[model samples]
Target: MRTPHVVVVMGVAGTGKTTIGPLLAGRLGVPYAEGDDFHPQANIDKMAAGIPLGDEDRRPWLDAIGAWAHGRAGLGGVVSSSALKRAYRDRLRAAAPGVVFVHLTGDRELIEDRMAQRQGHFMPTALLDSQFATLQPLEADERGVAVDVSGSPEQIAARAAAALDGLDATAPDAIAPDTTAQAGPSPL
Candidate 1:
């Protein structure tokens, strides 16, 4: 919404984080960062092998994304990550102040169907269950908008853009938070 508000599009696998992230960023005229780009080769290998990432495995990855967000402060960009836990979101927020989230949500059947239709992604449908288990929905206090994935990508992106711009009538709460004052990243 704001010029420097880092928007993290988060959700379990198959909720269209990758698909919508770029669209949202483009609509906002900001850079788009793929969360997968931050993962180490080892992590990718593990995921490709159908192994779920533990918190320890995610620490460095989260930090890298956080640091990127920190560097982009005041320039605003969109990034996509599962961000499946509250701690992970908190860490990201601490690293990049004024960060907001766009949570993609839907029924398991819809999501699993979507994942099954994908090809060449390191993350397989087999791990979707784990991803959902790990996902902690955005709390009411969190600065975010929960967009259901039932709509077309363009529809979702437009709604997200409008939400960020305080133009979304359906969900008026997506307005940007007051972020003139911000704190620096926390220690890793």
Candidate 2:
């Protein structure tokens, strides 16, 4: 078998990172690490106040997430992170040299609607516009795959897993293995 890769499920909030990350991890048979859990308290507080996080506010959190992902790479574990900007993703790559990113794509209206309907989350819809504005779409050299988020959670997870595993993107026969049921908390 090919070696399992550390996959970063990246996108703006409400693009299903939290939901899909765990399922992907379950299929890959690796630990799920939520990138949000690594955010600094101040960054979380800033988002809670409806302020978009600037690069200054994000640096430490990115470093932490990158370091964590690096550790996972060393262990052959799977990890999920937002990694919205190209620069941020670059930094993460520098930290975890061989990580693969799965960029989740969706319409702004759709993402905003999902964010509005989500519960128990500190990220406010007020920051959605800023996030959309700041998002740097995956560049050609990023070694990433972009999956549209208009499908069911299972579909999204399955696509990400297949891409990382080097299977056909739409291989219906290659169903994702269930990892969440056996793994602990998920991170994206």
Per residue, candidate 2 scores C-alpha lDDT tens digits across 1-188 of: 15555778889989999899889888878888888898989988889999888878878887887778768764555556677787787777767766778888998889999999999899999888788888888887566688889889999888877677563342342333323322322222
Model 1 — which ten-residue stretch has the worst lDDT?
173-182
Question: What lDDT score is found at residue 102 in candidate 1?
Answer: 92
Q: Model 2: clashing residue pairs?
A: 26-179, 26-180, 33-187, 34-187, 34-188
> What's the CA error at residue 95 for candidate 1, in Å?
0.6
Tens-digit lDDT track of model 1 for 39-137: 999999999999999988998999899888878877889999999898788888877756888999999999999999999899999999899888899
User: How many residue pairs clash in all the candidates, one count each?
Assistant: 0, 5
Best candidate (score: lDDT): 1
